[model samples]
Target: MKNDSYPTSTIANNTKRILVLFAHPVPQQSEVNIFLFEDAQLLPNVTAVDVYAEYPDFNINVIKEQERLVNHDVIIFQYPLYWYSTPSILKEYQDLVLEYGFAYGKGGTALKDKLFFCAISAGGKEEAYQTDGFNHFTIRQLLQPLEQMASITNMTYLAPFALFGSRSASREDRISTHREKWTTLLNALATEHIDLDRAKNIENLADLTINGANE
Candidate 1:
């Protein structure tokens, strides 16, 4: 995986170590996520990993992945939402790296108290993911499995930060706005400026705004 880390001296004091596990099967076709991923790489106290690029053979190193998790205070799963779930490689990564003894079930507390969340881009519009809409479920409802995974692993699960209408986001200013929000959120998360309680209660963090008031 591509690991991006800032020098120890350059990192802000008391900032959280953020680990972004980015997964995109075909990044060239992406209109927005690739830019967000690139922005994440430029931030201090953040480690961005392109999982697809690193584990093309599906041969993930379990020990190293566990170590990465242990070292970071925040974990972000960044990807394009596929069939209301994560990409196959990420699922595979979980299966291989989050072993019974390492993540849960009897003395497993490697990820305890850490924050976990996803950054997803959806092809459908926000309205289409409602009870009466085509998807017949909210984005939060569709992501229960991951939430439960975080719970079982002893990590605090936050609402996902999602971009809807992603297919057409590039046509207007939506893509640019979304990228700006992503950067702002990342910075807030790194500096512990984000309110965790509010984060968990929100449906999504796409429109999240952090200010001195919240801090």
Candidate 2:
């Protein structure tokens, strides 16, 4: 299913296409990411790619990945944070797929005007990512690299969608609530309910509570 976007969902007919690149090293053992990724795949007009599952060999085909990018309207990089960044395979994919004369440079407008952001599951609690916290840097601060990548590529870089404390003890109800919000956010993104300006202004999608919905 290389660059595949079959119409499995009937949520919206003429909405923008969504590409969710799901990267988990070991999904079966995962507690939070598994549920998040599973729910995302069920959304209509959304192409969710389990990167590791698709390319277990780590030998990602650049052409196929680029083709998928060109064909989608919204792009999501969903993964569990490792060492404050994406997993190795996704880094490898970027180095190979986002090449010269393609994603950047002359005639490299495949991703222009497209929505770019990430959905991350981190072990650190929300407060841990603040100035006075142990981590000392906000998620937004740490994710500047990807945000810069979007800038250079001429894409619209919105605030990230993050879930903190993935490894901590959490109630089943809390996890269920997170899933509901995740699904709602995906639907909003697909249907263009997200106001790009407002999304860009906030720190993350979870902050939507303070800023109100993207509508």
**Candidate number with greatest TM-score:** 1
Cα deviation in Å at residue 20, candidate 2?
0.3
In model 1, the clashing pairs are none
lDDT of 2 by residue, 100-191 (tens): 66777876666878889988888998899998998999999999999998988888998888888878625534677777778778888777
Give the Å error, residue 81, model 2: 0.9
What would the per-residue lDDT of candidate 1 be over residues 1-215, giving only the tens digit for each residue?
A: 21222111223468888999999999998898898999999997789999999999999998789888888889999999998999899999999988776788766777888899999999999999899999999999999999999999999999999999998889977888788788889889888888888999899997666875223
Q: lDDT score, residue 106, model 1? A: 67
Per-candidate TM-scores read 0.92, 0.89
Q: How far is candidate 2 from the true structure (C-alpha RMSD, Å)?
A: 4.8
The regions of model 2 sitting more than 4 angstroms off are 1-13, 209-215
C-alpha RMSD by candidate, in order: 4.9, 4.8
